[model samples]
Structures are given as C-alpha cells and as structure tokens.
Target: MSKQRTTQPITTGTSVIGLVYDGGVMIAADTLLSYGSMAKSFNTPRLYNIEDRILLGASGEYSDLQEIVAKVKALALQETTNSMESIYVDRKLPAKSLWNYLRAVMYQKRSKMNPYWNDVVVAGWDDQADKPFLGTVDKLGTTLQENLVATGFGGYLAMPLLREKWRSDLSEGEARALLEDAMKVLFYRDCRASARIQLAKCTSDGCIVSEPYELDHSNGWNAPSMIRAAGDLDGDGGW
Candidate 1:
C-alpha cells in the first residue's frame, strides 16, 4: 500500500541552469509556473539578483522559493546593518558565504523533515580572487560547487548539451548562445517549460538579470504542421 501524503507542492517551476565562463558566471531559467501538469502562470521570473553581485536561479515549489529568498534578503539586510559598525567588514556577503548560509538553512529544514523543496543555483564574481564562481544548493541542503549546474529536468535534458560544448575560456556571447540552444531543447521536450526565459550574469563589474525574453526556436522543428504530420504518420504506421 502507498503511504499517505500530508502535503504536496502546488505551484512549481522547472529547470534552472547555470555555468561559469571565461570571466564570470551565467544562469538562465524559463518564465513558467506549473500547477500539477498545467502551466498556471507565465512571465514569472525565477532569477534573483542580490546587491548587484550575486545571481540566484531557483526551480521548485514557487512558495518555497519565495520563502527562502525572503529569508536570505532579510539576512543580507541585517549583515549590511552590521557592516556599518565594522570598518573591516564588506558591505555585502560573498557568494560562497551566501551559498554556505543557504546550505545550512536547507539542511536545518531537512533535519526537521520540512525541506524547502527547491534547488537553487548561485553565481557571482569574486573580487579578491578576480574570478567567477558557480554553485548550487538543494532542498536537502546538498551543496555542489561546479562550473555547471542545473535543477529539475534540466539536469537530464540540458546538462549533456552544456557539458559537451562548455569551455572554461568561453566568451559571454558564446556562453549565452550555448545556454539558449539548451533552453530551446528543453522548451521542445519539457512540457512544463516555457519559451520565455531570463538570463543573468556575474562579472567583475556586477551581476545583471535580464528581462524575460522569448526564446527563438524557429528552425521549422516545432511547426504545427510538422508535428501534426508526424502524429498522423505515427497513427497510420506508414513506414
């Protein structure tokens, strides 16, 4: 017999992807919120920018994501207040430090058997090291520090494509193009995904999250007639 469930996620988001390139890190996610299998909302932004230095992309229960972000923002604000009292402390938190904090929070929740139900990618540039940073933390507080990371179906569908083409020396344009291609594949296959996506980057200057933009998949691959013809052929077994 199946065990009874007390609660389940209602609104959800799919697939958040991130990678480090030559000078910094980039992350992207589709603007879609799903209720069960239905696409409940569009134009939802999953990427969050913190203090113009860090980029956060999350995929999972929407409410859970909001809760985590709100808590983090509060923590950052508190840290900022404390920074004014200390001449040595930086005004903002470091990316790795923030990531670690999230890991701790997620773990605490997991220990209580009430996890956040989200997988989050954190990206930023290190001023001291003069380099880019990329990492991820999940609902169970599992932390992964990697040049590339993703959540949800993106792990299965987009990761292979990212791994095959990613290079440490990739320029910003190249990295964006690669991410767009991977997102296109996801939009084609992941029913819960959307063609509208937002891209964010962390560089020496700062982090910037773009407005939601439509993904271009106009390669005749998803033409309505083509899909209809393929379905008809499959139904008739002409081959």
Candidate 2:
C-alpha cells in the first residue's frame, strides 16, 4: 500500500485576527467555512478554547483544525492522567509549551510532505512572564509572535487598521471595537468571509469564546465612498 497524504484542503475557513490588549489577548474570525467557491457552513466556528487561557483560532482545512485540537486535548488528558500520581506541580500546559508543541507538530508533518493546511492564531496570557501572548503558526510550521497578528485575508485587509489603532494600553472595549472594524473590512473585501464574528479572549481571568454574532450593518455601508465605488463598478464595461 502506498502512503497517502492530504494534497489539498477542502471546506476551509477564512482569516483569523488577534491582538494583545492591556489586560490580556483577544482573537476573532468569521464563522463562514467555504467549500471551494461556495459558502458552505455558516455556523462552524474556527476558534477553539483548548485549555484554560489557551485560545486557538484557525483558517484553512476545518477538518484538520478539529483534528489538531482534538489531538492536543487527548495528549493533555493522557499526560495529566499519567502525572496524577506524580509530585510535579503545574500539570496544565503553559501557553508557550503548547505553542512550541504545535510548531513541532506542524513542522514534522511538513517534513513528511503532509501538512495541516491551516494558518493558526494562538492567544493566551503568560502568567509567569507577566505578559500577553499572541502568535501564528502556518501550515509550513513557520511561527511568528507579535502584538498584533492576522491570518489569511485578514492579514492583507485588516492588518493596516490594526497596526494603525493598536496600542499597549488599549482597553478591552477599544480592542473589540478595532476588531469589529477590521472584520467589517474583511467582509467587504474577502469573498469567502462572513459577516458573523467569533471572538475569543484570554486574560488572567482565563479564556472565553463569545457566541457568533453578525456585524452591525444597519447604516454603516451608506457612506458616500461606498456608494460611488458601487456606481463605478456598475458603469464601467470596457470589454
């Protein structure tokens, strides 16, 4: 039997964006999962709360995303069970440890010529380091740690807005507002994106994933620039 591997990803999710705020870290993603060019699933959230204060948001192969998180959870459970009779303190995996584990996993798979085909955003508060943690790991196992991180379309469409507005002292409310704006731009530009948002936050208080909600579009799209842009697209027909 010949060994087979995933050569292409199907039923994929779109961008994920994360930023560290004053008290902790926050991440956001659209709820739409696309199958090729079709808008397939609207309620499947890409954000997963793996453990206390360890939040993961991923874009690309939805099945692979679920599989990776499940494997992590299983590994943690097994390790915890084995250590139950031991005298080691802090059995729960720290954010940095988890991030490193993921890097290893992704890299190993890539070396085998099989990859998860996902771009991930991991957010948490590193209590020992007394700082917020925000990072990204790609299908190729390349890793990045940044105060503000965006994946997929969000990296192109939303990063500028985040870079322009993010501050070290930003309040939680301010951070959320910035995400809301960035997501709206993504919805407008990224064809695979959804108006619905899945938000997660990890602070010293622990991680919380919010219910999926739609961007408030009541009157926000009535701007003169949007109207003129729409008119231009309708009027131009050189072909």
Candidate 3:
C-alpha cells in the first residue's frame, strides 16, 4: 500500500514590488502575512539580503522562506574565503546567478514532494557588468520576469499600475517616486495589504534596506470626491 501524504494549506503574504533603474534595483514589500481570511501576523521580514549584492523578496510560507534565507546565507559564507581580498573581490555571484542557484534549491525541495509555497522576487546589480537586474521565482520553481514584477494577492492589482508608469529609461529618482505612488494605490485598495512598507535599493555599491514607513494617506486622490462634490452641491462646503 502506498503511504498517505498529509497536505497543509499554504500561509503566505501579499504585495511585493520589484523594479530596476539605471542605478540599481528597488524592491518593496508589505509586512503582512495572511493565512486565508485571517490576518495572521505583522512585522514579518519578507525582504532578505542574500550575501552582499543579491536580495530576495518573498510572498509565501514565511517559515519556509526563512529557512531558505538561512541556508543561502550559510552557503554564501561557506563558499567564500574570509580573506580581505576575497571579500573585496567584485567578481562574486550576480543576481542572475543567484536566481539560478535559488531555482535549483527550490526545485530540489519540490522534487522531495515538499515545496516552499511562496513567490519570490530576486533583485540586485549584476556583479560583473554592474547593472540592475530583477527576476521572479514562483512556488513551483519557475523563474522569469524583467523590468518589474509583483507577487501575491496585491500583485494582480499592483502590477498593472507599475507597468503603466515604468520605463526602461527612468532614472533612480523617477523610479522611486513611481514606486511610492504604486504602493500608495496598493495600500488603499488591497485588502490583504498593509499601509506600512519596507523598501530596499540594491546597486553595485550594495543593498540598502530602509526603515519601515507608513504609506502616505494624506494625498486625497482616493478620498470620496463624490462626497465632496455632493457637499459642494449645497455650496456651503459642509457635509
């Protein structure tokens, strides 16, 4: 008789954003990880720095991703000598190479009949050419994407807005501003998303993860304009 396998429902997150510009790549993720209808937790660190130059932003199975991050970091440390010259070498693994490495790791897990249930965005500057790079890896170990990518529930709502504003020619400043706008829209509209976000910029210099900040809600674009219009119908400016 074949052994029975128990299946567990996946616990995951929502709304991760990845973009590349002239200077480097930027990735943003909300801190909420939802388990079905329940908003299970907050303050989850979904964005991870793999080694020095590469970053991995994930949107599922918090525990599994955490394990993956730990293993990758350990492997990176093991692969490098502790000498100053080796540490200073600019010829280490690039974002694309890291992506390939992760694909293999994820695939190995899947082949074991137990997989990490998360979609991931891998972003950084390519160590060789020193250019921005971005890619997406799904729970099934499929890796693909370019320019911009998003994962989780908010992905459906957020990616279209990003693609509308994203340009290959955009400078770092423009990309940051556009991403801020996109996050605001997602926060207001995405039920599973949080108003708080963590942003990271990865360049040839290195990865810089910002302090968490709240999405600006003061920009009244999403406020009830119709209600304001109705109040104005009386011409008194009172509602």
Candidate 4:
C-alpha cells in the first residue's frame, strides 16, 4: 500500500501578532519553539527583518519558517544587486508586492499538497504608497490585510483585545503598549507561550528589531499565596 501524506508539523512556534499605527507597523512573537508538549528551545526567534522595510512574524514549523525567510532574503539580495538603479528610481518592489509574492509561494505549495505548515504575518512600510501595511497568510495560503493580525493561539486569545483597542490614530507608543498587553495575556493563558518576546517595527525610515527580553510579571499577582487569598475570599476553599 502507498503511504499517506503527512501534514502535521514536527516542531513549532506560537502566538505571533502584528498591528499598524499611524506612522508604521509593529510585530511581536515569543521566543519559544515547542516539540509537541515538550518545550524544546527557549530562545528561538520567529520574527525577522526583511529588506530593511518589512517585518515578518511566523508561527508554526520552525524549519518551514526558516526556508521561507531564506527565499525572501535571497530574492531581496538579487533585486538589490541586479536592479540597484531601479531601486534608486523608486521602481523596486514595495511591501505589498513582497507580501503578494509570499502569498503566491505559500498558495503554490498548498496547491501541490505540500504546504509549508506556517502562518506568517508581514508588516512593513509601503514606500511606493507611502503608508504602512500589515497582513497575514496562513498554511492554506489564505491571506488578509487589516489593522491588526495574529497567528496561532494569539488569533484566539489576543486578537479580540487588539480589535477592541486598535485605532487609526494610534501612536507608535500606544500601539506597542497594546501589543505588549496582548502578549501578556497570551503568556498567561497559552501553555506553549513564554515570557521572552521579540519585537520589531517597520517605518518609512527602516525596520528595527529589538533584542529579546522577558516581560516583567513580578508584581506578586502570579504568587501562589495571592491566588490562595483570592480563592479564599471567593469561598472556594483554596482548592
């Protein structure tokens, strides 16, 4: 008998989010790669800066994510070298074009029944249009653009928060605060999520990815004694 095709991923990351503010776009993802239920890598970054204008956040199989990043980087390098004058002449590919190219690649893989097993968020400044773009493509090659986007568990746990708070006039500081708050919610609720997060932004000037850092949760709310106290107050007998 012929073996059936396997669609499941071996290892994965989870809960990446992106949003657009008045001046730019921001993306965030935790640094955890899980092997099933086992927490394998505690510091695996799933967000990348592409072409100095795009910030890509990926969730799902790490190998597949790496492959997609490599493809984009290679294409960007070729475009930069072979069409340097075109780039200066404002004929280079913008963020929307890059996003569409990536979506096409993902869709082609899916049509061949060998999808990359990833959900990727692309955030960037569309220099040609002179505005920010934030969008996502899924394993099935489905794509969407919106003020906010999240993949994996973040879509469920954190998207609602963003949807409720996102505004067209949001400043960068305000948008980053909302994103961080959503990350905190994901960390508290998602078993596969971690405290360490990587954040990046794409603006008209350039893209910048901050070094990984752990969110502060030391305000005693996570303490067992606090939980017990709240439980006791609720008369649940501190079960």
Candidate 5:
C-alpha cells in the first residue's frame, strides 16, 4: 500500500515579530529550534540582515528558513554584480524588490503543493523615498503590511500587546521598549520560547543586528517570594 505524504513542517522555530517605528523598522525572534516536541537548539537565530536597509525574520522549519536565506544572499550578489556591470546606476535591489522576490518564491512553492512552511516578516527602510515598510508572507503565499505582525505563538500571545502599545508616532526608544515587552510576553507563554533573542533594525541610515542577548527575567515566577506580604501563609489553617 502507498503511504501519504505530510506537508506540515516537522522541525521548526517558534515566534517571530516585526514592527514599523517612526523612522525605522525592527524585528525580533527567539533562538529556539524545536524538533516536534523536543528542544533542538538554543542558539539558532531566526532573524537576518539582508542589506544595509533590509531585514528578514522567519519562524518555521529551520532547514527551509536557511534555504530562503541562501536564496536571498545569492539574489543580492546577482543584483549587486549586475548593477556594477550595467550602465544604469540605479539598477539595484531595493527592500520592496527583495520582499516581492520572496513573495514569488513562496507562491511558487505553494503552487507546486510543497510549501516552505514558514511565516516570514520583512522590514526595510527606503532612504531615497524616506519611507519605512513592514510586511509578512506566509507559507500559503498570503502577504500583509501592517503596523505590527507576528508569527506562530507570537501572533496569539504578543499581537494583542503590540496592537495596544504600537503607535504611529512612537520614537525608536519607545518602539524598542514595546518590542521587548512583547517578546517577554511570548517568552512567558510559549513553551518553545526562550529569554535569549536576536534583534535587528532597518533604518534610513543602515541596518544593525545585535548579538544574542538574554532578557532580564528577575522577579519572575521562579522568584522565591511567591506570597503577598499582606497574605500570611504560615497560619493559613487558623479557621
């Protein structure tokens, strides 16, 4: 008898988020790679800096994610080489162009009935146009541009927090705080999430991706003082 094939992702990274701020865009993702219900890696980054003004964040199958990253790097090289050789000075890859390219890739895979099984967020700033953009594309090829977006459990756990905290006039500092808060919420709720995260930004000046850093989790559930000062537990059975 013939067996059926599974199209769902087997090993995956959980939760990635992206947001657009006043003059830039920022994205964050955890470093946990899970194999089914098992923890695989604790230091695998899911965020990538594509160029000086473009960042890509993905949450899904790690192998598929790597393939996308490789494809993007190859495309960048091809575009750069073509720009250097062509007479036209502006025939280069822009953030939107890269985003469109990824969209096409996912769409093609979906059409073939074998999708990449990833939810990708693209954040970029166009210096010439002086505009910032944030968008996401899923394995099914669905694309959306929003003030804030998240994948996997992040969408359920952090999206509400982002929706409430996000503002059009938010400064970079304020945006960073909001992003961190959202990440903390995810870390607290997602079993596959960790306090260690990678953060990246795309601005008019350039892109900056930070090294993996652990978030401050002091005074959390692990703290020893679990009871309120007003409520005495020692003589709880007085009645």
Candidate 6:
C-alpha cells in the first residue's frame, strides 16, 4: 500500500521585457517575487536557458512557472534517450519547438479551466533561417510578435517607451541602450518594478547575461524636494 501525497500550489511574482535587434534578441526581467502586493523575496531569476539557443522569461504565478520549467526539463530528458550529452548536442529541441510545446501545455490547462495564470517571452535565433525571433506565450497558449513585448505592470509603462524607440534595424548597442532606458522608466513608474534589473542578450553566438544593476533615483523629486522647491517648505509662501 502507498500513501498519496498532497501538494499545495505555489505562487510567484515577476516582470519581463523583450526586444529584437539586428543580430538577435534581448530580454530582461526583475528578480522580485512578491507575496500579494508586497515584495516577499528577491534574486529570483526568471530568465532560463532552455536549450543551447533559446531563452525564456517567465512572469506571473511562480508555481506555474516552476511546473512548466519542470515539464520542459523532463521532456528534454526523455527525448534525449536519457543521455545528457545527447540532449546538449541535439538541435531538435530548439527554442521554437519548445515554444510550441509550451503553447500546447498552456492551451490544455486552459481547456481544463485551470490555467497557470502566467505569461512568458521566448527569445532566440530562428534555427532554420538563422534570423532573430522573439515571441510571447500566455496562459491561453497564445503566441505572437518579435518587435517588443512586456509582461506585468511594466507592460503598460514599458511598452510605450519600446514602441517609441524600437527599430527593426537597430544595432546591438542601440537596442541594449533603448532597453536599459525603458527599464529605468519602468522602475520609476511601475509599482511592481524595482530599481534593480537583470538583462540578457540572445544572439546567433549565444546568450549574454548582465550582472544585476540598480537604478538610481537621486535626480527624481521627492515629497520634501517638491515642497522645498515650491517655496512652501513650511506651508507659508510669505516666509
């Protein structure tokens, strides 16, 4: 006789951004996992290197993301004949393939009326044409786009900035600078976004991750500064 184990659902927090460049793609996300509206933890890496070429950015419920990650890991293991070496070398498990698989998983979950409530951005080089590709997949298994994408609170604030500066022919440096600026904007505007950010670039060569960097808000106006600058520090302009 065996005892059945019961599992409690896990929830996580995140925000993500992705943009395409001339050579490949760039994606970024903050590392703050929240419990409700409050920041509960930090340094949670939402970006993942699923295969040699693909990168994934997950946002929303942490438990759902973990389950998806686990599913991908298991599928990779099974498809590789249980050989680690084979899995690494095989090109069959490319990013696009993984994207389709994920979409299916999400769609099935939605059909069952128990969706994961998470969104993901998949960025990588198109294996067949050797071109850059960026796309998003939500809980409903919908996948679309490459120019620019965002998830969570940053989506509302960051997407506008992205559209303003985005260009399909941007150089790598230009694209990176644009993204960094956008992140800065998000940090200042979006309540969920923190001053710290983690960024990654995916090219034909591979993925390059930056050390987490913090945003400085010293130049921005605070309540005291606003009051002082308004010539009403004591609430009496006559002074």
| Number of the predicted model whose TM-score against the real structure is largest | 2
Model 2 TM-score, all chains together: 0.93
lDDT values for all models: 0.89, 0.88, 0.78, 0.87, 0.85, 0.78
Candidate 2 lDDT, 1-239, residue by residue in tens:
99989999989999999999999899999899999999998999888887676898899999999989998798778767777877774477667777888999999999999999998888888888988899989999999999999999888899999999999999999999999999999988899999999889998889999999999977767865555543366544322
- Per-residue CA lDDT of candidate 1, range 65-89, in tens? 9988898888888889999998897
Which residue pairs in model 1 clash with each other?
none
In order, what is each prediction's RMSD in angstroms?
4.0, 3.1, 4.3, 3.0, 3.6, 4.7
Q: Between candidates 4 and 5, name the one with more favorable TM-score.
A: 4
lDDT of 4 by residue, 1-239 (tens): 96564489889999899888989889999999999999999998888888677788889999999999999888887777767665454344567777888899999999988899899898888766889998999988789999889999998999999999999999999988998899988988899999899999989899999999998867636666556544477646763
Model 6 weakest lDDT span, ten residues long: 2-11
Model 1 lDDT, full chain set: 0.89
Better of 2 and 6 by TM-score: 2
**Residues 101-184 of candidate 6: C-alpha lDDT, one tens digit per residue:** 888988988887788778988888776878877888988889877678888776788898899989889998898788887877
Shift of residue 39 alpha carbon in model 2, Å:
0.6
Q: Which candidate order results from sorting by TM-score in descending order?
A: 2, 1, 4, 5, 3, 6
Per-candidate clash tally: 0, 0, 0, 0, 0, 1
What is the C-alpha local distance difference test score of candidate 6? 0.78
- Name model 5 segments beyond 4 Å from true: 1-6, 222-239
**Model 2 regions lying over 4 Å from their true place:** 229-239
User: How many angstroms is residue 188 displaced in model 3 relative to the true structure, after the best TM-score fit?
Assistant: 2.3
Identify the runs in model 4 with alpha carbons over 4 angstroms from their true place.
1-6, 85-91, 220-239
Angstrom error of the Cα, residue 170, model 4: value is: 1.5
TM-score of every model versus the real structure = 0.90, 0.93, 0.83, 0.89, 0.89, 0.82
Where model 1 places Cα greater than 4 Å from the true spot, the runs are 1-6, 220-239
Sliding window of 10 residues with minimal summed lDDT for model 3: 222-231
lDDT for residue 57 in candidate 1, whole number 0-100: 81
